[model samples]
Target: MSSPSSTLGGSKHAIKLTQGLVALFAFSCGAIVANLYYAQPITELISPSLHMSAGSAGLIVSLTQIGYALGLFFIVPLGDLLENRKLMITTALVSIASLAAASLAHSPGWFLAISLLIGFSSVAVQILIPLAAHLAPDHARGRIVGTIMSGLLLGILLSRPLSSLVADHFGWRFVFAAAAVLMALVTTVLALTIPRRQPEHQATYFELIGSLLHLVRTMPVLRHRALYQGLVFASFSLFWTAVPIELTRHYGLSQSAIALFALVGAIGATSAPVAGRLADAGHSVRATLVALSAATLAYTPALVHPAFGVYGLVVTGIVLDFAAQMNMVLGQREIYALHAASRGRLNALYMTSIFVGGALGSALASPLYERGGWTLVAGAALVFPLIACVHYWFVGRPHAHGRT
Candidate 1:
């Protein structure tokens, strides 16, 4: 593949996006983002081994997300000031070390600390995404973001099953070890192939960080889109974190069966690119409605899992994944459009809110599941997206038409 023209600094010309480069970005994104999720399905295995109480097992997933949110807020914005490829590589290296440490962790405290670092370093995926947005031309931005997001979503959907399968045979620690190896390869490939982008925005790191609040205060679209996606993503996180428990305890599925169940959820990832095309075609408002509505209804089937069996939970997972991912891509396209030079910070704010919500959901998973079972978990999940739908109906629709 041809290399991108040297050192894009405030250029009006967008880099020509090659298929090879797109594939590389997608693969790297999938590999990097997968780190945040590898622990989700295996919390049960890890918790007992690390001497964590059943009631606190959800902390495993929640702390990772909390770390990711922290990175999104504090680290991802550096993508605007630092050289993009180098920033990504350096971050990935941190991730590799964290994963390696996680593999060897002997105590719950030690593992939890490493989990936070894993999530923090995994912010490289966030950096890579905005970089992709920077490189793409305006007309194709949504489609390109959508396509790359497909990889990220696939990583999220696939990681659970892949981790479960690996852990089932090789033990949970092996999952992190293998992830570190995969990340090492991905980091090397991205460093060699991905083109460089240097942002024109000139500000002290402190000022750059401070501007995040200003951006949130000034950009109504950014705030709205973030709120919408955050609510839905909370629902998404809650389901995935708690569902494995439900499948195992309620349905008596083995880890291998849970792996297959997660693989079925991978089907929902197909919506990412479709959502992107919709955003590009000026149908974002309508598509947003559909996504939110689908999310609201996704939990209904899972609430009656005893009557419908695992198949009902399967349906819920697929629909919820589809809705959440569709909404995510759509939100990214919207936020990325808001400012070119500050795509990093915009994405930082947007995704920070998303993972914060995700952290909350994951934190609540164990307690809710233990207290009231799937019925309560499903009820809470239903409420998240339903709240977003209500806000959109009363507030968002009137202004959405203003966008082309």
Candidate 2:
């Protein structure tokens, strides 16, 4: 087998990642990926403050995710076609401008537009993950990917509480302003520390995207991983979106209280590193089943009698996020190993599907909550992981196809 240094860039050896560089990448991922979730916990504040309808305020998050999906399909593929460092830096710069605009917008319409741009540019996180995989030697890829993903998951889980706390005191706009500063710092650090990785693919931009369909058609592991993660992420989005409203309406918890709940949920971030090590040890299949089962069971507490209350909700949130984080690392470890040259595109497809699931979950959160409350939402959320579990058992593992 060729060393990473020998294989990458036709050099004598692969580009080796220093511990400092890995830490920087992890920091950069968390800082930038937080852009997608800061608005989740503060939707109510945003609506009344901006004089927009509740529905329109929800679009702030939805539009941002939609933009992320767009960027994944359209811009993230460029990671394969261009130099990775330059592409990631450019996206970070765009996120800085978009987030600054978001902080300054007075009207809902303007903010919604800016939110989309924020999501779109935040695809920089996706680019960085694959680049890390590219740099790591084959034996250590899963562990490295896991570490960075732990940071990414931390960003996703922590963003809500941090924003809720910031918005509760300083107003919601301040959250974006704070994020812009963080992005600027991340951009500077990434520009200085990240090694340049130019993929050998010479295809034109259009051809690159067009090949996504071909890749999807040909790769069953990609399809399975994408579908499984997508379903689980949908459940994740539904829980987070609806729980904020639930906390206030049912329990009379304030934004600061919700922040605490989010903080507790951050414990799930531990699963990322654990899952990565499991994959590296060739226990990905067992790890995946655990993730699926945990996801399926995560909502059981929420279904119990009302007296379970906030405790159940907190438990559910912790388990739910842990399951999702674990499953995603396993998926990335699986897909990233499929084709070295195509990691960026594979990640694009995998994440685009996951975000699409998230968009669906967010879209359904309000209606499900209004119609049947948390019970209905919990039931719906449970179905996704259950279905994924079935697939993992019956279809995903044949030994002939691939590990989960």
Candidate 3:
């Protein structure tokens, strides 16, 4: 095989777009994805202030992830059957409203409910991605996608420090309120600028859902990838979920310091675009393997020693997340390429599994950390990618057909 970045390796079906359009879409991606993660840094402050328990405090985050999962499975597939530009615009408005609700919640449970809405509404990212893939020509798909994903990853990474600093100085409520404003701007821009896509699938809701089920049943590539990517997401959330407490407990770091550490890891996600380029060049499967492997390696230090391993885990987290995002971009690219008409259904299968993993990860992080310390938590994460790797290598890759 050629080097991973071998100038696109002449893949005809890969998607490409105009540089100007790419820049605009990438900016939109960062702005929109930021809405989902802006709340991460404020979890600590919000739980205590709202009179919720430590574990229960996490419910806000978990429920949002769950809502996103629901959107992936239930709402995103409709992109095939609906007018996508209008759908994304409407969803962004709903997202803005949900952010406002979350900002104003008076009780912990109320906050979680609003979080669910925000998450569900945030599936605009899902629709945007498929649309991006569809809009671009074949050769530059990876490059175009990489460009947009960079924005998304940047938002995820920076949300921690940005939100933390805002909450610390102004108040946590200001964080959500501010994001709502950004969402409104994003909603307006997308509505005005996005070109329209006519609906293709006219299946009923159940019929659409059946398409997703059929995808999981028949598409070996999708199933294999979802299995690996699902656990990749779970491990991703597991480390992130525990990192705040570890920083405070073992290092005696202040909230500000913890926020800084989260920011550091977020910066690591910049690897997504480079990975996407590799995929466009015909090395996507290998790139996916390399990414999952790196993530597994990142979990190693935490298993050996909690205190010293904490620092290593932080460094590893950066690498782990970079790899996970790489895997994600490549997997989605592969699925979308499989059949243009089925992009939405393929995405639904891929992301729903990932969100399920994320939800499970958030719920498990506290108990896993509490019971066995960082070792079990890290070790457990260490196992998932390897399992996924094995299944993909043996069962999934050999039988797969060519994608677009």
RMSD each, Å = 3.0, 2.0, 5.0
Could you tell which candidate, 1 or 3, scores higher by lDDT? 1
Task: After superposing candidate 3 on the true structure, give the runs of residues whose Cα lies further than 4 Å from its correct spot.
Answer: 1-16, 305-310, 399-404
Tens digits of lDDT, candidate 1, 169-245: 99999999999999999988887777778766788999999999999988878888889899999999999999999
Taking the tens digit of each residue's C-alpha lDDT, what string does model 3 give over 1-404? 11111111133124345687677787787777677677665787898889988777867768888988998888998888887887888888899999988888889778888988888988898888877777766777777777788777777777777887888888999999999998888788778776677654567888988877777887777787788889888888777777766666667777677677777787666777787788778887677778778877887666665556557867767887787888888877677677777787788889899888988887787788788877777788777777777776777666333432
Which residue pairs overlap in candidate 3's backbone?
14-138, 15-137, 15-138, 15-140, 15-141, 16-137, 157-266, 337-404
Model 1 lDDT, residue 8, Cα: 59
lDDT of 2 by residue, 1-404 (tens): 22232134444244568888788888788888899999999999988888999779778778888899999999998988888888999998999999999889999889898988999999999999988887787888888888999899899989999999999999999999999999998889878877777677889999999999988998888999999999999999999999998999999999999999999999999999899888888898888899999999999887766678999998999999999999999999988887777878999999999998898888788888889998999999999999999998999865313622
lDDT scores in order: 0.88, 0.88, 0.76
Give lDDT: candidate 2, residue 352: 99
**Descending-lDDT candidate ranking:** 1, 2, 3
Query: lDDT, candidate 3, residue 113?
Result: 84
Please estimate how well model 2 matches the true structure, expressed as its whole-model Cα lDDT: 0.88
